[model samples]
Target: MQAEIGTPEAVGLSSERLERIVPWMRGYVEAGKLPGLSVTVARRGQVVFSRSAGLRDLARGLPMDDDTIVRIYSMTKPLTSVAILMLYEEGRFQLDDPITRFLPEFRNMRVLVGGSRAKPETVPAERDITFRDLLTHTSGLTYGFMDATLVDRMYREEGVDFQTAETSLADVVAKAAGLPLLAQPGAEWNYSIATDVLGHLVAVISGQPFDAFLRERIIRPLGMVDTDFHVPPEKIARFASNYALGEGGRLTLIDDAREGRYAKPRSVPSGGGGLVSTASDYARFCRFMLGGGALDGVRLLGRKTVALMTANHLRGDLADMGQPRFSESSYSGIGFGLGVSVMLDPAKAQILGTPGEVAWGGAASTAFWIDPAEDLFVILLTQLMPSSTWPIRRELRVLTYAALIE
Candidate 1:
């Protein structure tokens, strides 16, 4: 269902201030810093501000719009986390349960003790990796591209990247199991393939393929029509081009919408970063979270489960774990929850945000945050690679909050 569009004043925000987002976003497109962008803001279930700028396809001159589908990347994690919690409510698995119960390969795991990538020394893991470890990213798993540690090198050697189309989720997990973990289970926060494992677990426990489970259980229920693991033939025209900053700060096409791998389905559906969605479709998902796991009378999770998922599960600041190489959010006042980052202290974060705000961004410069405090949520969609390339999320937050008059 489409959200009801309303004036900012209706939602207790200044219409004049909300209009500033247009020029601010247009400046990036006009300067050729971004190919295109779309922003959506909703308050109390009404869409207060929604606008798009620039082109979805530069060559074709297709402008970005509400329906333009883009790769959401790591934003897929929150959905995956929600799916896990849905199954948890059904008595599928416990948060602290060892993942080895279903995926035995994770049992008797080894951690990198002390050695080089060529011949890494290892020791047995202190304990089996649990669902909490996977959810909180403390499972010792590491993304191959995020760091250059020995385990990360091993991940590279084992073909542990997420872009592959041939390898299945099971195949990737098996390969990852053979490689030594970067740290012991629950040792420290390491953004890794843990969510992919959770995706595989979703398949294992639900007895359905990961994509099938997500589609039938979550996507369809939420009415996220344009969201899926791959863009179909008819929807190809609506898919946005993925780009990266090139030499001398020019937008370079990195993935073509029509010819990219996302144009077709893959065996391995990356739960951590492998879904495509439009601004409206994703806003629906965010609205579901904001509604306490329900939207438009369709409840995907219990309200208590939603509360549990958004709560800060981490003991202290995420920065204390280690310097985060991927996420742009300040770790000082941030703590991780099931699949998204939870704001713990806005003062220490030095960002215009509230505690209990749950959010996450994608690798392709897309971000969404749910502010339960203000009954607000914002979605910023774009096609730039390495979300860190620009401080758009932080700036968007400032722009969004400054517009609130009430």
Candidate 2:
């Protein structure tokens, strides 16, 4: 139902090799590694392999379908990045401009220099954080769940969570500003709440609520009808139950589709990791990225802008940028682009991927990558918490590229 479900051979993929995906998926389901999942592989502009396997709701006897909606988490970053870039294209602000021109909550931001969580030593940032810093995740912002440092603890203590409706985005930014940054702006490439800050920047710059802006501009324009911050009551039936890999290798129910936070509207949507989407719906978004920021004749971004966004903006690979242990990709050869991770060298990363392929994944293990070199893209959707629970993304990469016969 997404693009055209054509034969794999037509797109330089082996039909017989593509069949290997089903058994591999069933292996995970049968082994209790995944409850249900779906994969969409498209070449050029047409889908050559698309399949949904296993059960979406284990208790409800619901099988994973092409339209099943699941929390896409951080995959929401690219959309938010594109939204802000649209404002950039209007000459609203320069990439190097200090973000103090924006909300100004971060005007007095400090960098952590020494001391402990109880009483940390800090120094005023030598330079103001920029829009480019936020886009590249070099803004020194940190997420609460990283749970790795004092800044992260401060975020949690301040209740600066973004994936909830309880706190406003404005309030979260204000709280984040009160804490010391994990690093100096543009000094380190920490995976952080930078995108959430970008979401607030979108609201401030666009004079529109973040969710409203996204729906009116990117989502609706790209035909991602099922992509949103929350699942409406009418569409709750298609919302998959979220699970956590529990002790003894059991699937633990975390969020039920019948009643979850996503069932209600989000007051402050997280640009980093707060959106639900389907395989087909997400495929539409991927098509937009592959089409140079247009889908079906509607262009939201120019070709040069799209190229700039996908190109690696970091000085070098992520490892050289002082990336932390927690990340959506390997640090060795992967590089950070504007809002996505750009593969720099598969040999150095020790992964099977082409250089320049752009990707990002969610906390629930959902992932998508667009490979301009291959004229290909792949989307994987599942509802599992803490993406580190499995090596599926890496394995899926191997399974996928190995099937390309051309």
Which residue pairs clash within candidate 1?
none
Q: Compute each candidate's TM-score over C-alphas.
A: 0.98, 0.98
Q: Write the per-residue lDDT of candidate 1 for residues 1-406, one digit (tens) a residue.
A: 7788888999899989989999999999999999999999999889999999999999889999989999999999999999888999999889999999999988888999887766789999999999999999999899888756878878887899766838688989999988888888887888888898999999999999998999999999999999999999999999999999999999989899999899988778999999999999998998999989999999999999999999998878798776555564668899999999999998899889889999999989899999999999999999998888989999999999999888
Candidate 1 Cα deviation (angstroms), residue 71: 0.4
Q: How close is candidate 1 to the true structure, as a TM-score?
A: 0.98
Candidate 2 minimal-lDDT segment of 10 residues:
1-10
Clash count list over all predictions? 0, 0
Q: Model 1 off-target regions past 4 Å? A: none
Measured over all alpha carbons after superposition, the RMSD of each candidate to the real structure, in angstroms, is 1.1, 1.1
Please write out the lDDT profile of model 2 over residues 36-82, one tens digit for every residue: 99998999688988898888899998999989999999999999999
Q: Whole-model Cα lDDT per candidate?
A: 0.91, 0.90
